[model samples]
Target: MEQNLSLEQIQNFKGKYPRQLWYLFFSEMWERFCFYGMRGMLVVFMVGQLGMNDRIANLQYGATQAWVYAFTFIGGLFADKILGLRKSLFWGGILMIIGSVILSIDPKNFFFIGIGFTIVGTGFFKPNISSMVGQLYQDGDPRRDAGFSFFYMGVNLGALIGGYICIAVAEGSMWQSLVPEHLRWNVGFGFAAIVMIISLLTFTQTQKKLGTIGISPLLEIESSKRKRMETLTYVGSLLIIPVIIVMVANTVYTDYFMMFIGPASILYLLYEMKNFSAAENKKLFAALIFIIFSIFFWAFFEQSGGSLSLFAVNNLNNTILGVKLSPNGVNNSANSFFVIGFAALVGLVWLWMAKRKIEPNTVIKFGLAFLFLAAGFWIFYYTKFFAGADGRTSLGLFTFGWFIITFGELCLSPIGMSAMTKLSPLKTQAVIMGMWFLASAYGQYFAGLLGANIAEASEHATNLEKLNVYADGYKQLGIYALIAGVILILISPLVKKLMQEVK
Candidate 1:
């Protein structure tokens, strides 16, 4: 039987007030404001401003995103063990703000610097804040999932707003007259930087209130040996990065980042062995399994920003509500649109299930996520029916596909985060979370590889042939995803058993 938490525990779990959550909400909102805004524009900038092929641009874009998530694991570790959550959050936010400013300069050097800073900032900010959300609820608190669901909604809300707003500012009609084509990229990044500052300020104001509720997880640790090993791992990874860059110079492959992932994985494995226990090891192994599957999920889903974005620009009819829409505006907004509309509903569904003792286990949901995503891609694949006379596709078909993809994301992303927190023991949470992002990094790399194949093939193929390639790939991916989902479902009962009441 489940033990009901005491009233004191309930009050304690509220963590200062609902307002504190709101403060974090807005802070995250702005951070995502920068992230999604930049993301919406990144591929477009790569292809248009830099004059790279779609294949090269998508590959680079995927690498950047992979690094963003991969580094978050490292950042999460720093916050967990060294910097403490608040300081880490502050430093990360500040660095991100600075990165945003530099990116607004729109220099080629600034691109590298922006990626670096954004990576550092995400490292410091992402997991710590996510951890804080869990801290808001006491052990065995029933409301923990509900609270995370609420918080996850904030994430989608931010993504939704940032997606549309950034596209509007970046792709506006006024830009033709008010700004030069080359310099216009700065406008979106500048806005993102300003919003990031506001987010930082919001967090600063709420620190005292939040401080009373939960202490930093790093406070009680006294293991210098663990610290030393972590330092060594990071330094080693840093030293090897140049070698990887050199290799990238020589390789014919588009994904230069995979070389980095190889070395980074080695460093991480060595680090995990230091002072780690058997249970933690099991959890890490399981987490790695989930991470592996997530790569396929994200690779396909992320095409929305790259291949899909370009597809929308080139192929989709963008007339909506009797107003001519920018292709960027339509394409970039799809995930955000579904996220904003359905996030709350998905949360409510989970809450209702939890109430009835029927919430699907995380692994099972992961399977469902894969199938749903595959189904969405299948929708696009079959929608050859909607391809227009001018070789365009219906905006409606793409919209429906995005909705299905978002449903898949809803099943995976938040639930995955929650699993990362709950399944792992206290000591390795950040590194494990980093591993989660690493999977995404790999997925992004794969997405880039796939996009490159599409782009390269397009050079030889007619438009109809190109569309057929996309359709065929989509169909294959759909079948692959269906198999993954079915396998996960078959394994679900056992995976749930492995979780051992972690739900």
Candidate 2:
């Protein structure tokens, strides 16, 4: 399966990869700018401005994050059949822009509405864009992994810039002269909306370079039928937005929603298994196993946005060498900074190992991811020993912990994205990609459960008590991650065999 490129097309780029990759790269970068910008401040805003208890805020954050990914399955279904990737991305961007504007209005009731819109919009946009990236390369292209790595770097680049900028805006540090302190968070949300518009424009202008890759729907329909379907989609989306807003505001309902959808989704995948050839079935099963493991990895890893953000604010020292930093925002950027710094190096290492025929398989790479995640948590757990009289630990330690987890992310996230495209049957590619994110949804839900404990424990009067609670939680998480990593490594060979020659 060669790329859809003629000799002239091949010669035009004069680069190792297609020219479209750059366009996708920039498009994704701006989309991520909108996403991570708000994400960097979400929990903080909920706790500080909205005056929510930490437990409620954590639950809401977790539910919001979960729905954001969970809804991707629906988005992927629409793209795989009715909407096509291009239209999905376009509409998703429009919805997100609107959501960001709504979020800027007020953090009370409007927050849930804003989150609801963004969740659905991200569902439509995120997975389809990634699937388009996969379509740019041929099956078994060695550059495929490297291409995704480069794409992942763009994601992190957006995170790095947006994280800092949003924090500055929210804190009124950047535009203090123009914006009042009370309205700074609104300014940050507005910034996100503005960047999302840029992302939509970039994709709209440059998507033609994709050469029909994501331009048409997978299932052809009559023009009249297509219009009807599009109308239904719009109506359905509008109706569901309020439902999601309700779920996010209610933890029990959110839990029930996840419980119902999680197993139902797996059963749906199982029911579709009969559609594939034997070999494809085996590969899909392997992908499913990896996806399940990914849920575990993400459950712990995703604490960065919830408990970890709170940890930075309430527990870590924000002063570094006499410079006061915004701990939550700066800490959020740490993982992205590490990714930007090391992604290319890691890609080179993987390529070098491949040349020597010693590259680890995808399953083993996933195992390594769990191991790194375990180590990262253990590092933070150990920081309990260094807690000062103020009950705060060194900011450097938390940053270093994030640095280690970035390595774990490099091993899992982009590699998982590549694996989904490689392993799924061609007919169901986008849905499978959505399943990958669905794993993250489960992880996010689990993160909320775990973070709620931290929030509950943080209610203790003494800093020592808070540190003890966090330490206890991390100690258990580290142990569980270590065991999971080891079990995955032990079974890697079997999973690899199931892959049936997919590396």
Candidate 3:
């Protein structure tokens, strides 16, 4: 496959995809195992183990997620010009392993340190690996979207496994014989670190399957120049560690940092826009529009880890068929389980639609995503009416809500990844991918802010009061999302024009 077949021959490849897809698939699976494992437990650990209030925990979690994504810009810059994707991924995986290990120690001061390292590590790893996936196919490859969906399935597969294992272990629902209850969170973190080591090993052993793809910097540089760039990256990374630690510890700093960085990043992207041709510029403008819309989508969608998790704990009856389950565990694993079960079907549907040239364009797909998101939230919001005397909704409702959200994710997330590669100039692929995730950074920060508000509003309130607060919030968000989806649909024709038929 690496021999660069013509489009016809490439389209005729086995399994309708390249062999390297599996290597990347498994590598990303394990990496996500490490990432989601820790993430599933973070807010819960803060609330339970560290005795933090929900407001504080939500803010910190938001800051951590925001910074983790924000650093992708720096990592993408390094990979595009200096380290290349392979080296960036390797170093990123190493740092993540280290961070997970630090979290396993469960020391107080080291909490932020661990989060800091993991954030920077993820910044380096996540965007580069995804960019590598895009590198596998030529421009206009018909198989690109399906391949990404299959790859996305791998991501959810890992998330499913990691979410269940990490949450079960943290809750002492599993491994009680070997892991003490008080130390279970540490064990969960350690398990994540072990999986990261496996991810690094898998990628290292199988990267040869990728041939020359992601093997070198996009632009050639002298050895001395490369060395200096690497040195600067190292120094800058080290310098930022303490700053991230400080920012995470202080909400004021975190807010100010995001406010400044958000505009600054957009300005830089605009400056880079001058380098593209007119057609490329139009596509980028469209990309930016989609990016902005995605921020809103993710802000609500990401509640799975924050408000939704809390809702499960506080207001959901977590019994399924008379068996008890961990609320957060179920919540964390729900969307992933649905994605794992349905992503192939979704992919096949896309392929079938594409055969007739009827597949939705990127913008329309994004609009569908918002519509689904609104529907999912509305599903949950209306459950307030079904609350029993105990003020608990059925576990089935939460599960169904996530199932719907998974459909929305299917429409937006992977398509957004593919779109970044297709829409941006080749020179700025990684940077634009980073910007795509930067939208996620903003979404995470907004989610944190929203979660904090909900926490504060519900403080010392009854279960009914909490339900009412959440219901009101979800209703407003749902209406907003529905309106956004409508707007996007109306504007999609124009956006497609700007895209210059890249799809």
Candidate 4:
């Protein structure tokens, strides 16, 4: 007689998590440390050190972020089908190390060179690590969402350290007597490189514990057909480089990325739709809707790195505990701090509500995210009327605004990952996860466009004047967010029905 699985066994089942996940987690953590640490400094460095205008710095930052998120989808695809997660991850670490070293060189044109390598490295690293987390669990595993939560915590942990700790070290004065000015920033990059090396070493040492996970793809497929297909795809993709270059160059005239990703995403969805049952179809629809709305939320929220960063610099006083702070880095830290502190709270609330059978569904969480986001920006706008002669606003106001935005991110970001893992059927799990990430990529792109818009009018404006312009833009975004939030709240009940109690 065949054995049937019982509820107790299913609920209590422990997936084998060896040392590998920890290694990957730490590796990812350090990589983020490098990425966010650099990011925190980039705006300040560009404007302060390089004498670049606010508009240029904002544009550059947005473009870099857009490429980073966009490549997550590419990384996911290659890992799932070609290089396998392990090799891709290892190579990614190597590339990032190279990038960091190049950045440390601090050449006149080091920005472009370092960013180029970082983008390439991120393309190999980002998606594969997330996929490996899923690989740790089995099909129909309820724990999958929880596992991703654990993984995302690792991401936030790195961000927390990078945003505050690393930045503090690089820019801090406690060690200033011991370190020279020219070498200070270089020390930061060096530290990042060392961390990458440590992560790479850690992963290699823990390989045996990982079991057969993240192995190379060559082991699975036959040599002949797979080789031909890989070569063809690579060549075809390369051949389209000129076309992509032209599109990127014309980003102003056309929403080239959306024109491509939107139709492509729709086609892919339709193809996948046929394979799903009615219940699964409903879940997919719900996810799709959430993804669209989430993009709008992110476009506004992501200003933290662009307009908000600038605001913290030009418009807000940065003195804290008698130590002068970098405006850009200090405000960015708020989001990460909230993620670390509130992730557990959010998780607990979900569990507590689930037990009472009164948990607001995923859609509700997203709607609330929009409300918080809009409220934060509106609060930011309120501070503008009190601007000082130097155009500096109260630091307390910026802090309070960041606190509100943190709650918004906590609701939307972690929950989106949870919903994606839960609602996706087993066979298409990785693809769906990739698509989830793809939406984020689109959001990052839109964020760039938005930042570019605010900065454009202020091209010749002083930093303070440009900040006022950005604040006005924030007020408008606040209105847009409010409208979007209400719409989501109205349809949330219907979306909740489609969820089928996956939570």
Tens-place lDDT digits, model 4, residues 140-216: 55445445555667777888777765555566532677768777777766667777777678767765455556665
Better of 3 and 4 by TM-score: 3
Error of 1 at 330 (Å): 2.2
Alpha-carbon shift of residue 307 in model 3 (angstroms): 1.2
lDDT of 3 by residue, 1-503 (tens): 54454434533456667877888899899999988888888888888877999888888788888888888877897888778888889989988998999998973557888998898899999999999888778888767888899899999999999988998898787778989877888889888899999999999998866766776573466878877877787678767888888887787887888888778878988899887788889999988998999999988987778887788778888787788887788998989999999888888898899999999899999999999999999988988987887778878877888889899999999999999999988778998999899889889899998888988888888898888888778888889889989999999989999998787
The runs of at least 3 residues in candidate 1 whose Cα sits more than 4 Å from the true structure, single-residue gaps closed, are 1-11, 14-19, 107-109, 173-182, 212-281, 460-464
TM per prediction: 0.86, 0.95, 0.95, 0.85
Error of 2 at 22 (Å): 1.1
lDDT of 1 by residue, 1-503 (tens): 11243324434744423445676777788788788888888878777776877777777777667666766766776666666667768877887887889888873556766656776677667777777665555555555555666677777677777776676666663346776666677887787789889889988887666653334454456677556654664465445444433433232332445666656774776576666676656656666667778888888888877777766666677765566666676677777777777876787788788889998878988999998998898987876667766666677776788789888988998778777767666666666666777777777777777776776766566556666667677787788888888998898776766666666
For 366-435, candidate 2 gives per-residue lDDT tens digits of 9899899989998889878888888798878877888998999999999999999999986688999999
* CA lDDT for candidate 4: 0.70
Q: What is the C-alpha lDDT of each candidate?
A: 0.71, 0.86, 0.85, 0.70
Worst 10 residues of 2 by lDDT: 1-10
Q: Give the TM-score of candidate 1.
A: 0.86
The collision pairs in model 1 are 66-441, 73-434, 75-123
RMSD in order of candidates: 4.9, 2.4, 2.1, 4.6
Better of 2 and 4 by TM-score: 2
lDDT of 3 at 344: 80
- Compute the lDDT of residue 128 as modeled in candidate 2: 95
